[model samples]
Target: MIAAVRPQADPPPEATRAPEAVLPQDVHATEAVRATEAAHAPGAAPATARRRPMVAHDLDGLPVPRAAYPLTRLPRNEPHASLDGARIVVSGGRGMGDLAAFPILYDIAARLGGAVGASLPAVDAGWAPVTRQVGISGKYVSPDIYLAIGISGTPQHLAGIDPHTRIVAINNDEQANIFNVAEAGVVAEWQVLLPALLNALDHPGDA
Candidate 1:
């Protein structure tokens, strides 16, 4: 039987950096540098017929695959805002209730110096733009902090979030899957909590 396993966090950025052009201890590392030099070298023979070394079915009977980048894109009345490299992402879901919740979400994001994201349902319900959708079919996000409001963590949604990102879930449902993966979670209604949060954000320390 197949078992579910949560993804582990990636190593530190410095540790994940590409290896040096030539590592003294690694003889194979020098090949990349040598090949680069050979590419620009004068009168160097081109490797036109070369293919990857692997064990596979007969190439003679297989069809070649083709791919292409889109040349044209659908235009929109309002320009789409990208969520790439956002430091903080305040995402909402269908559980956020009516359309009024979105303005509050946007306000919160602005106050936090972050971007807004949404689940598929919210996008389809016309509460949020498709550009703001986060999921397997949507844009992948690797933010420092992801604050999920009224979002039930679905595999489709979670797939878009990086393992390194810190998740903070705010949901009324006690059994929400979001809490399973969240670093921290709050069980409360966003309507009640968001207003209070906004008040706190507006006034730092007044009783």
Candidate 2:
């Protein structure tokens, strides 16, 4: 007996249409997509980065640099003549911080009729003015007597003093480094020594 024939059917045309290509997933969401699309759309060019211009501000209402007055160069001048007859050079150092000590030195210098000098530290610390500084970076002084009060005799301070001048250092400590360079070392407090010196000066015949 012959088998019954089965009917053949064609695939639906819509199904045959290449399965609609899967569109790329918008990973970022709508706003980002819109921004990206706006940035890279046809006929859209990348923006040029802009540089900000520098703004000038006047300094505390001061005039501008170009408008400021030009400084004039003054003629070089020499210092006044040193006193040749100056008998003594009374010098002080940083150790003399006690404000009370100043008057003693001042009085001693006045009595001896000598100029007052200062070490570099004293000047730098504002204890003494720069004008009175006697050191490597200050005035070089040569006098008959160099009385150093509490000075430790740093090389810089010694640089300004004359080598031939008789150096007298007064300090409370006997082992002070100043004693090494002093011709006469007095191991007594300057506060005590100064008054004693003043009294001796005032009284002529005293042992």
Candidate 3:
């Protein structure tokens, strides 16, 4: 036998439904919201009470204040030697030997109108000031011409040197790492080379 189908009735409308009973917690929460709204309403008193101005009391037996002292400005020291924007940089390393080599390096730098820089060991040995040191731990430089004197060309030292600069390495050891990166190299001792270079600079035709 075939069964007859019956349609389900639709749910009641929200407007016609009875309102839900408010719980004790919900009643308390509604009262709190109303209280907050009333407290912040226009012409309502401030939530926080006004405080009285505080009076500072001096301690008995305190010492009298001292007179104002005048301060003198400190005299400026010699200007710091910077290599940031130099046209050329003549840098020396430990291979140049002792503090004596620095003056020669400085002279060369001066003649070339360049700045003087130093490697870690030269600075540590007191041959050059800390301000002149160049490496990862020191100043980074990018000059038109970078004249590296007796520098072994460690990765750390090379890190401070710009790759675009024309590197001229002067070292007695032909196999020195500096030669690998140098655009031009001179395999000779600084003692012999420096004097010759200075003399050449003094007399260009003789050079």
Clashing pairs in 3: none
The stretch of ten residues in a row with the least summed lDDT in candidate 3 is 24-33
TM-score of 1: 0.61
At residue 195, candidate 3 shows an lDDT of 59
Model 1 weakest lDDT span, ten residues long: 26-35
Per-model tally of clashing residue pairs: 0, 0, 0
So what's the TM-score on candidate 2?
Answer: 0.56
For model 3, the superposed segments whose C-alpha errors exceed 4 Å read 1-81
The RMSD of every model to the true structure, in order and in angstroms, is 21.0, 42.6, 38.2
Candidate 2 lDDT over residue span 12-111, tens digit each: 2321110011101111100000112122122334312221122222222221111111113221243322334456877788778744455556555766
lDDT of 1 by residue, 1-207 (tens): 111112133312332211121111111100000112222122333323222122222212222112221213222334333589888898999899856678777666777778889999899999888999998778789888788898987767877887667677777784676755565445566765565555555554431
Which of the numbered candidates is closest to the native, going by highest lDDT? Answer: 1
Of models 1 and 2, which has the larger TM-score? 1
**Candidate 3 lDDT over residue span 64-130, tens digit each:** 2212211132212434346879888999998978776677676667777788899999999998888
Rank by TM-score, highest first.
Answer: 1, 3, 2
Select the stronger candidate by lDDT from 1 and 2: 1
10 residues in a row with least lDDT, candidate 2: 26-35
The model with the greater lDDT, 2 or 3, is 3
- TM-score of every candidate relative to the true structure: 0.61, 0.56, 0.60
